[model samples]
Target: MSPMLDPRRLTPRPIPHLPEISKRFDGVVNCSDDTNIEGWKKLLRDDRPMKLAAGSISVVEIESKVLTTGFLEFDFVVEGTGDAPEIQILCAESYENDMDKGQPRSKDDRTNFRTGKLYGPTDTYFCNTKLSRNHYEPFWWRTFRYLRISVSCPPTSSLIFNSITYRSTHYPLPITTSVSSTDLVDKLHSTSVNTLLNCMHETHEDCPYYEQSQFAMDTRSQLLFSYTISHSDLLARKTIHEFYASRRDDGLLETHFPNPGRGMNIPQFSLYWIFMLQDHMIHFHDLALVKRYIGTADGILDHFAGRLNEKGLVGKFEVEGTWAFVDWVGEWFTPVKGFSSMGVPKAYYEKGAATVNSLVYALALKSAAEMCTALGRNDTTTEYLERAESIIQAVNEHCYDVKNGIYLDGPGATGQYSQHVQIFAVLADAVNGEAARTLMRRTIRERETLGLAKASFAMSFYLFRAAVKAGIYEEVWEELLSPWKKMLDQNLTTWAESESMVRSDCHGWSATPMYEIMREIVGVKSGWNETKIIPRVDLVNEMRGSFVVAGGDTVDVSWGESKQVKLKASKDMEVELVLRATSIHIKLLQGEEQCFSWT
Candidate 1:
């Protein structure tokens, strides 16, 4: 469980230098004016609408003033056709222990689940309201979604308006999106659609794109999105290659880049490139792109392999502390020692989250396995798989915290749910029957665990399946809809940058997984792997999809009209279908795959 943070408790941690970073990077981007700050204060502070649409009372436009996590506050703009509408706002705040570097919980502990109010932008905002209200304010307008502006009126009240009005100090609107049928978004929604989609584009001169020293990480609370998107891969690849060129006498890339243009040194995290490369493969299954990162993957695998001690577990380079693990946010760890803290002592090695080490072990060995497969090197493939299995065994044996039946956050030292631990365990596909069931139970039963409901949006996909495997399909389904419904209530279709859990921005790397859940498993995996499908049509699941896209160089289509589903992966790929009402043949070939899972 999460630890309690009181005025008395003290934990030395890295202070997010966003304000300082802001001032340092000023001129290129100017800070909001005092008036803008006042606007922000009013919006977040008193629930007042600083700017409203001329014809409406509830619909108002707002913008982010402070640059902390990349989210600027936005005002709710409801489009009332004719009459005044009632309004209500729901907000969230990070738990107190969230600010600390060393994890506050041991692997065996549960999330604190306790919430603290955000201390608002101004000192007075913090004071004006109850502590709970204070915690609800944005720290620096980090990205967020599931934002809702509820408007209610009598059936007779017909107040029509064109659109809601907002005051944007920076850009005119925040991220937004068009609503989809499957998603239940209904209230006033996001102002920007790109908030969650921009992470894959987080490149600067030294980022995946520019690799420059002058570019700032910009947002302090922004989470990591490792997948490449659209044209983003081209420059990201260039920056990564060059950064690796000088930095890699050894083969791995850092999981992150720091100091503007510099690459990260975390040996294990550098492996994110492998996962990213795999995602790129899934996108187009492009052999050329797969070949490009093949060498880089092998090098990283080898570098990490070099660090394994006699016991074979990779060390905690991503997080180093007094037995501390990845800081609560899951970034930057001391590379000092493998399991033991460098210069600290052999005993210190006993501390740290076994889950994180499990992640390194998994990432390292899996990357090696995938690289070997891409290279068609059998022996290397066998070697990496064996290594991965070893970690899996160790994880099963030591990391389970078996008596509790739930995976521990990490080593016993600093244990708490930060989302990464729970997510890493789930994604690794390492859990067995009962253990998987336990995890599924915990995912819904516990909301604050590892920020599962807040920060890790993609993590739910795995948890949902795990939950289904555990037999609570309905609850898992609700888990899926809860936030999305919150978004729907706000009239949104795409992923939100941040929900109550993350209470930040929707992420590109994170959001892409939603499609996987939508089409691949529930809907269908149509293209290469060339998933050949026998579509099921009863809607045993709550799927509302009509078409699924599959294939590459040659596309196969899977679609549903009434009850039947079909798949075709060849030139003008085709599928035989039977539903409650329609029977048809679909011709598909765009060198892509589609979904139509209905039997």
Candidate 2:
């Protein structure tokens, strides 16, 4: 029988950030005085219309006097009523680095430039005198660091703006975590924080610039980072509840939450939903709150469990309309021999389970077992653990090529391989120690030859985790610099959806490096009673940072010298300090501190 728990005791505590205030556009881009108004109008005409550009393509520039967050609404008051006038405003949180800039009529590329700007531009607001109100305001709040406003009226009529206001709105949450380093890690951290803040609203958005949808894969990364940096679970909890609310008839959770208009399904995404709850449990320890969704988790596992074949693998899900998507790149499908572009392997896409999917299933099952154990559901835990072990053994037997020291995409050990399969193997504990180390090294070196699926920002979270877990700290550190710095080089204030040309430039998933910095570099892993600190000191020569773990307790760590590490706890907390091959455990009473050194 499940243990009885009080729901009230599981309510998450508040973490506060300063409230956002309204800020007006710094100044008009092309038109400051009446003389320049015509020029601005002309530029607007040259620019694509709102329906053509997902965002405004060309217009007069308007900057905020100071950069601010939480852009909510825009208000414009037109003085002069000779004839009904129309105006268009383009908004962008990062205008100068915007991908839509200067590409007014670019053909639709599906992601950013999809036909019909239903989502509008990164920031596009339109107002016409149809409503007969002198003041115009949009229905919803927008995000932007800049705006481009254009006014159009009857040739003989005069239009003047008496007042203009841009209101910003967001769940006010303070930036509690801090990171200071001698390298550009701090810049990456700050930018990642900005991305997270932008994507965070009523729910966690994949990217505020584009879809503004809360995706499972994206939310998983944002949720982990939010706990470490924001030190709050309010948004995370809201997101969890939202996803649970999207449960489908077949026991699969929808790919995204607040389902805009139509319902959609992704088989792999449902797996992520399970993992998400596990993460929530680890960070918040609110079993009572999590108990509300045990049915959702069980339903998902039951559905998948029924489909396992003789080899303990879930083959192609024959459910109609089900999208078996694993990641953005098509390489998620088993790659064709001697072919660079990834396509569905007819053998597996129709009859066999993709190794990537199998590993995810095992990991999800493992996570379920942990959640069950926490809730005192020993029976469910045993069932899930057994199923997870079976899948793991099957994966190693079918997917791993002992001769090549690599993992294939599917059964029969296809010559084709991807970094994805191996990464998840480590994460699921299906591979460990020397086996994990060798696979990671080969993944990096044989990347080109194997057509190893390149990880976009979203998958990079697992890729980094697997790399760190393999005890290859230096490589993980070195690998992080390029992808992020490229975004910076492109003048992006936030990480892009992928390095793709026609994708949303600001994506929350790309912010994995921030979580890595706090979790792996500082090495803070929170538990119900004890927090673990296993610093990857080799990654950086000298570093200092602080993060709040599960119980709303702040922990700080710094090491300047080669072999010394210092830690301070804000409250009484038990911590385990792990070195390369050894661990030093300590218990600190209230307001206590400790330092350790090793050679």
Candidate 3:
């Protein structure tokens, strides 16, 4: 099915033309204005061109209020000439030191351009000494908060810098959601939106810098977050189709689609593709789209089912050139005898099955079963559920640590514990009710003391899910968000790849707060074609927000001290309100505002 045929799909919007918020110029001469910075400002404000004399080398730096992705554009005029001048445009998320060592530098002041140096991708343009009215713009989009344009001219040529502007580009997603709460929550929400914007271009990239490959796991979370703020699913649909096209002969997906290098696969990431398919079904309700990929889901599950060991738990991927990555916990960075480690748990190398992998398979089976049921394939649905149940049962029996009241990384692998196993245990239904709640509670409380490897930014999404399932989201809300809060405190304009902050500083996987804030704090949950509002009244006294529902309608909600809710919808639909252990159903008429209050 062509995604463009969908009536509900939003049309792409035009990219905006933006001027820099601030500018700085160094070593600039022969301008009409008194100072170089003033000259640049006049060029932006009054359309006056800044002229540079011959034999001058100058740097012009510009800053945006936040991170942005765009095309750098400028016009230049060269009059008297000997040799063509060279201009280089450099973009960076932040200025830093010791970039070669991969060390984390203090970036608390992103606007302090003079303190540090810019380190990122650069584009160079050599001007024509004889040509006039030269317009320069790179073909590829550049992501940055700070941009520097350096111009060097020979002694015989004078250069004229006419104008500089940024033609900002994104997926053209209109943000239909808003959150009005504490300062921290507000900043986190806005920062998350910026981070997601930067990571989204032609595909959902892990980060704008370093590697822009679309990994299944990262794309899954990014799609969910996108659904909460915007009704447009064109990008999501494209991603699903691309991943489906990237399926290998063995029924597993490549680690990241559109990869031109050697073939690589991560067994767990294929399972994430199943989760992505199910997520699409829930938000968009496109049965045709799901039907097209349902067989592919089966192919993936079948491969994992064939790999189950004697204990009924899914074993590690033994295929050559495959990585069994679970999480990026520091303790999981085990050194191999002949090769470098990639943060794979030591238990995976030991003699037993990894609980995280088995649990992830079980979860994917459950998701696939839901899609099958939606497609009216009852037999396939039952088979998938049964398969999932068996894996959950096997994990509970073999991987559970009875004495410690925790699940080990693998069967009989003593002292092997991690937050990933426990998070998945609750998600895959290896445990339930109070047991699940208690397990998650203990997992969070004793993680440091028990030496349990913590979940990084990517796995934290599941960590938050497990918390919500255990009904402890309100209780541990602030604690679970400490990582994001720390990032905010560190003056990070975008989310970091991990708490270590050594790699990419703008990873979309770290934008989980965008989803969590909308779903949990504001309490807008997607239910097929309906909307569920279950605001966390206990934690938040008053809040107001709006988000797009499955039916391509905007639902606005506001609640405050009177325990009153004011809701408005664009179409006639059923809005379910759950408050203080009571469920109330209300019929919201089209184009009418409804108010409900609880004692």
The numbered model that scores best in TM-score is 3
Tell me the tens digit of each residue's lDDT in model 2 across 355-443: 88888888998898989999999999999899889999998888787877787778874676777888899999999999888788777
* lDDT tens readout by residue for model 3, 1-599: 56756478574543332233322222222222346877777776665898988888888766766777777778889977588888888888876654466765645544445456677768888887668778897877777777777888899887898877767776667777877877777888999998998888778899987788899999999999888898778888889988898888889888799789646578889999999999888888889999999989999999999889999998867657877777777677657522323666677778557889999999999999999999999999999999999999999899999999999998888898999999999999899899999999988988987778889999999999999998888888889999888878767789989864466779999999999888987788976767788877777777777677876687888888878878888788898988766788989888788877777
Candidate 3 stretches with Cα past 4 Å from truth are 1-34, 97-114, 337-340
| Candidate 3 or 2, higher lDDT | 3
Provide TM-scores for the models: 0.53, 0.81, 0.90
The whole-model lDDT of each prediction reads 0.39, 0.69, 0.82
Q: How close is candidate 2 to the true structure, as a TM-score?
A: 0.81
Ranked by TM-score, the better of candidates 2 and 3 is 3
What stretches of model 2 exceed 4 Å from their correct place? 1-20, 26-59, 64-81, 92-133, 162-165, 260-262, 330-351, 561-564, 579-582, 587-599
Per-model tally of clashing residue pairs: 116, 14, 0
How displaced is residue 148 in candidate 3, in Å?
Answer: 2.4
Task: Give the poorly placed runs of model 1, Cα more than 4 Å off.
Answer: 1-251, 257-268, 309-311, 318-350, 411-423, 446-455, 458-475, 487-506, 509-513, 520-522, 527-529, 532-562, 565-571, 574-599
User: What would the per-residue lDDT of candidate 1 be over residues 1-599, giving only the tens digit for each residue?
Assistant: 56575458664432212221121111111112333444434445455454433333242223222221333333233333344334433222211234445544221101122332221222111111111111223443332221223234334232222222221111221111122223221121221123333232323211111122211121111121222111123433444444344345656443344344444344444555566555555544567766766777777677666655434455444342223223223222235555333212122245433455565457556755765676677787898788788766665655555555555544443333333445456556676466666676675667564343223344444445445455455545645546555543433323443332333323332343343333333434443344433333332333332333333222232333543333334356555333433554555663444444344
- Order of quality (lDDT): 3, 2, 1
